[model samples]
Target chain A: AQSVTQLDSHVSVSEGTPVLLRCNYSSSYSPSLFWYVQHPNKGLQLLLKYTSAATLVKGINGFEAEFKKSETSFHLTKPSAHMSDAAEYFCVVSDRVLTGGGNKLTFGTGTQLKVEL
Target chain B: GAGVSQTPSNKVTEKGKYVELRCDPISGHTALYWYRQSLGQGPEFLIYFQGTGAADDSGLPNDRFFAVRPEGSVSTLKIQRTERGDSAVYLCASTPGGSRTQYTDTQYFGPGTRLTVL
Candidate 1:
């Protein structure tokens, strides 16, 4: 079993401020993690993924996440937040199978990000 | 021709009415998935199909929700006796099968079909 827990329900950040969204995971098997963004009235978009490769994964929109196995966390970070960054973000985990054969994604509840200008 | 497509855009129905949502995956893509997103919530997995067979359906909330891919291309999700709690935006995604490469694991999403049950 694999699951993800997003730490914040809502995060308010001023424009140009740093942004951080925390996520933790639980899995009996090797875990493949991902970050997805959903803008209002739009479909969910993939930001980044950690499939047990590089510890740090860079995603779209200047966002990145570091997978810390020891901490069981994959926390997203951005040097600066933009007004366009206002959206809901989700953390997802998948049971790692060889060659990404097992691709069932388990989603977190999601964190709403509000960036003030 | 470019991305996943879902029909009806929006649907409003009375309780106990039957509703169907359609999805047209990218051409030649062999994997398809369904998810439900309630207001302020992330997308929840409902079902997934590999080729013509459903690979996983454990996330389906109940038996009333069923999906089919007759020709392994266009699919339909049917909800029988819909209830108020069933209201949400239904999203469909498609990817390549077998490999977890960028084109396969990276799913292309549709705008979604918003369903409102009164």
Candidate 2:
């Protein structure tokens, strides 16, 4: 019974400004968390993932997220927002380890980031 | 080094009709997955295949949804009696190995096939 909840359905930010997309999760055991970005008409691209090794995970395009166990959160952040950064972002959790779901991914509803220039 | 690919980028059919969506995983990938994504929603898991066998199909919504990875490389997701509710983007993903390996944690996604049931 692992799930992810993205706090915001849509977020708008000015170019070069800081950006933040919040996500929370509920899992019974240690969980694997991931961030994926999807551009229009394109496939999902892996942004970053948090395993047991790292709490502050850095991803491509200068994006990063911090895995907070106590807060039950994994929030994605970026220092500067570029036009290319505007896309749909998903917070995902793995279900294989605990639920025997064979590496299935449970995704949040997703947050659409709009970068305003 | 092509990424995972899916056929018929878009499909339109009438309700009660059947449809088949295909996926071609990355060359060396041993695990394939199927997911359905509705508008403005995250993709929902449908099934997982490991080397030609479906290791997990519990996520399938109903018996009308079925999938098969015949040769461990290609997979076909068959939907029977399609309904308007089934209209959504069907995404396919693949990973290099099974859950036993660390690399398997990352699932590469395809562009997805948008299905519209009229």
Candidate 3:
């Protein structure tokens, strides 16, 4: 089974400070990882994805995640946090489909980011 | 260019009633997925549809939960004998499946339908 675990349920950071959200995964095969953000009552927005091609993946809104296969980790990071960055973040792993189509995503218990001024 | 869209933005139903949630995927997307999200947890996959057929339904909780994508563009999730535990946000997403030329298989999500079973 492929699964992802978000280390923090909530993270608070002041504006202009650095931000980091940690995630760990367990997978039987090489995994495709992703980070998605959700605002209140809104749809999920894809921030970034790691597809084995790149160890360091850059995403929308200045967010990035580095996939470390040795550690089974894909941690999201941002150098400077903005107030608008306050949202819930989810770490997802793709479980391979046996029928040779798109894989189903396994999501982590989200992390709520609170950006303060 | 429209993103995925789900109908009945909010639904309030009584226990033991039946309900149907609809999803209209983005134009030309070949894959559609349904998920259920609780108050604080991430979305849980319920089913996956490729074209007009369900490629995977293993995530469905029980026999009362059923879904169909007859036309390959729109999908409907039907739940029978709904319980209070089924009260949650039902989300739909779509992606370009099995496209080798595409760099990423990212799924685009809809705003989601909030279901409340009282």
Q: Give Cα-based local distance difference scores for all models.
A: 0.87, 0.90, 0.92
* DockQ preference between candidates 1 and 2, better one: 2
- Tens-digit lDDT track of model 3 for B32-118: 999999998999999998899998898999999999999999999999999999999999999888675332488999999999999
lDDT of 2 at A98: 17
- DockQ-based ranking, best first? 3, 2, 1
Per-residue lDDT of A102 in model 3: 58
Q: Tens digits of per-residue lDDT for model 1 on A47-101?
A: 9988778899999989999999999999999999999999999998877432224
Query: How much of the true A–B contact set does each candidate keep?
Result: 0.34, 0.55, 0.55
Q: How does model 1 score on DockQ?
A: 0.38
* Model 3 steric clash pairs: none
Q: What DockQ number belongs to candidate 2?
A: 0.56
What stretches of model 2 exceed 4 Å from their correct place?
A98-101, B102-104
Per-residue lDDT, model 3, residue A116, is 96
Clashing residue pairs, backbone N/CA/C < 3 A, model 2: none
Query: For candidate 1, lDDT tens digit of each residue in B1-118?
Result: 6888899899999999999999999999888889998887778778888878887777799999999998889999999999999999999988877664532177778989999999
Pick the winner on TM-score between candidates 1 and 2. Answer: 2
Winner by DockQ: 3
Candidate 1 lDDT: 0.87
Worst 10 residues of 3 chain A by lDDT: A95-104
